[model samples]
Target: MPLVRIDLNQGRTAAQLREIADAVQEVMLDVFAAPPGDRYQIVTEHPAGQVIAEGSGLGIERSDALVMIQVFHQGRSVEQKTRAYAGLSRILAERAGLAPGDLIVSMVENTKEDWSFAGGRAQFLTGEL
Candidate 1:
């Protein structure tokens, strides 16, 4: 599953949020060939003063937003990952209206062996009952 966290300004409507999420998911599907069922998105809106960018040397800009995406997949090579990143960045810049450099997107991989659900009692990798 891909869990995407979008931290943006507290001004967008629900429709805007849904559109952004859909665009992001489309990138993953197109670039990485991911299935629709394996994707999930969480958008969190923050107040003006809650987030700050250190390197900017100024207060956080209203337009600044952080998008973090964690993808759990199997056997994806560096080349594939690189392509996905590029595609995601481009899509976010064009569709989401975020400056390409300002958007901080990250991907994390996990083997089924390292994940669990149901209060950690059910191991995903081992299929424990």
Candidate 2:
């Protein structure tokens, strides 16, 4: 399973937020091969002054529409990750009206042992996953 965190400026409506989250989960299912109902996502909104996202000289103009997505999951191939990047960008642009330049994504790799879905037990290790 992957834990996804979405951070954005505080302005979008609830529907837009849901669309963004759904778009991300869709990519996880398609590219990461994550099963249905494995979604664990959190969305946080901050004021414009609170979120200081810059392009790092990439020459991309980031605005209040900036969105930062962080995914924590098991290791994935480079190709899979690259596809996720592209898929997320395309989906967000088409579905949520987010520009590719306003989206930032990062992934962190962890082992199965790092997760405990419920009952204070490691589902993967216990073969319950």
Number of the top TM-score candidate: 2
Backbone clash total for model 1 is 0
Model 2 TM-score is 0.96
Summing lDDT over every window of 10 consecutive residues in candidate 2, give the lowest-scoring window.
47-56
Q: What overall lDDT, based on C-alpha atoms, would model 2 receive against the true structure?
A: 0.92
lDDT scores for all predictions? 0.67, 0.92
lDDT of 2 by residue, 56-103 (tens): 988989878999999999968899999999999999999988887899
Spell out the clash pairs found in candidate 2. none
Error of 2 at 55 (Å): 1.5
lDDT by residue (tens digit), candidate 1, 50-120: 65444455553434565545565555678878887888778877887766655555667766665454575
- Cα deviation at 101, candidate 1, in Å, is 2.4
